[model samples]
Target: MSGRDLLQTQLERGIAALGTSLPGGAVARLLDYQELLHRWNSAYNLTAVRDPAEMVTRHLLDSLAIIPFVEGATLADLGTGPGLPGIPLSIAAPEREVTMVDSNGKKVRFLREAIRSLKLTHAHAVQSRVEGVEGSFDCITARAFASLADMLGWGGHLLARNGVWLAMKGRHPAEELDGVPPGFRVEGIHLLNVPGLDAERHLVVIRREG
Candidate 1:
């Protein structure tokens, strides 16, 4: 099989392992996004996982694994370096409005190019500190961006009423739970089983309380 074929097979199998279905052309777009990231990564160093196949497992599948938890029409991916879950989620669910937020100029530039090239009509990129970003979102996602306390402290105000906050962490963050700051409560912590990835993954679900 060719390299492209391998990537396709890997992505397909990983999607199947997740037991979820994506819209038609989603797989193709995802591969295209991966290719774009790979090419840009050569000069920009977007991510450390350099292999395409590994990108399928680590970047693509890992992001898709939280699809079930992601709700609401508007989503803000804070500290979204290279648009991880934001880009993939937008490709998978074209209807959701996704905003990829990052402080780094290069990453935001790459995100804009990806949005344009991928034709992600509902996705937008903003180069600003997470706390500085404006607008309320139905859902917020931060992938290992910062500690729970710090993330919620800085960007908690951006979450709309009854909005869900999904924080992706490598391990079960028991210690950080206490640091979740006031006005926010831990709803649940879900373990993510990403295909072809043998590492620990946890999604901490939080919500604003009255």
Candidate 2:
């Protein structure tokens, strides 16, 4: 099957799974997010997963699994390569503001285009290093962005008071968390079951306490 066809089938199945496993209304927005990603990915190298079915596992479902833990507040996706959790999360929660930041101009361009095409009024894209972007957010997300220490050094300032940092990791990140900077505490570690993908995923929630 063509990439588009495979993607559609996977989306249908994934959405069904989400509807059964998660809350309603989330699946439909995920579908819309997939469509937006596919359209922009054709022109920009936003994601390495060219096949739609792969995207369902790598992008859509993977992103949706984190929705339950995210507090309903403004979020900043640091080093938002290809808008992983940011784009999908924004689609799922249109009422919440999501700012996606990437150092690469091309990726930021694609993210901006996707937001405009989807008419995501709550989504914004910024092309700058995490440290350069000035603002506080209720939540800061990072997917394969960097080591925990690096993220804390650069993206820590962007987190609002009482905010949390959600970091997606593969395998147990015991070593990564061991060296976390001061003022941040590990709140919780959640094992995520990403549909259609056979991989160990963990969402580490870090909070700032001053």
Candidate 3:
């Protein structure tokens, strides 16, 4: 089978394995997103995962694994290198506002192009340090951005009072808890079962302490 077809097959199986359903045209859009990433990655070295099929599991599925926990209507993806969960989540939930922030110039350009090509009216990209981003969000996501404490130090102000911070980590971060800021606390730690991925994935759900 061709690359696109193979990616489609893997995407389908991965989504099902996550027990998630796609919105209308989500599969196509995601495939397009993956293809775009692949194309740019050739020259930009955007991601380490070079194969399209692996991108299905490592990128798309890994991003979607947190969809069930997404809350509210506004989201900010800090340090969104190539717009992982940000773009996919924006596509999946068309009504929500999704802003992707990255400090890198080339990645920001790629993100803007992807948003334009995808016609993601609800999504926008900002080229700035995570701490410098303006505005608040009902939900925030930081994927491999930094340790829980350090991320909050920089981007914590962007989370609305009642908002939740979903920090994607590769493993259970037991030691990282000690460094968590005084105002925020770990609400829950969810083990993410990304399809076709054997590595440990955890979503550290954090909230402001009352």
Q: By TM-score, who's the top model here?
A: 1
| TM-score-better candidate, 2 vs 3 | 3
lDDT of 1 by residue, 75-159 (tens): 9999999998899999989999999999999999999999999999999999999878999999999998789999998999999
What is the clash count of model 2? 0
TM accuracy, model 3: 0.97
Candidate number of the best lDDT: 1
- Estimate every model's Cα lDDT from 0 to 1: 0.94, 0.82, 0.91
- lDDT of each residue in 33-101, candidate 3, tens digit only: 999999999899889999888888889999999999899989999999999889999988988999999
- Alpha-carbon TM-score of each model against the true structure: 0.98, 0.88, 0.97
Segments in model 3 whose C-alpha atoms lie over 4 Å from true places: none
lDDT of 2 by residue, 1-210 (tens): 965566667766775676535435555556666777777788876787877667789888888788777884799998888788898888778889999999999888888877887777999999998889988899989996788999999889888878899999988798888878999999998998777789999999999887
Model 1 lDDT, residue 26, Cα: 96
C-alpha root-mean-square deviation, each candidate: 0.7, 2.7, 1.0
Ranking under TM-score, best-scoring first?
A: 1, 3, 2
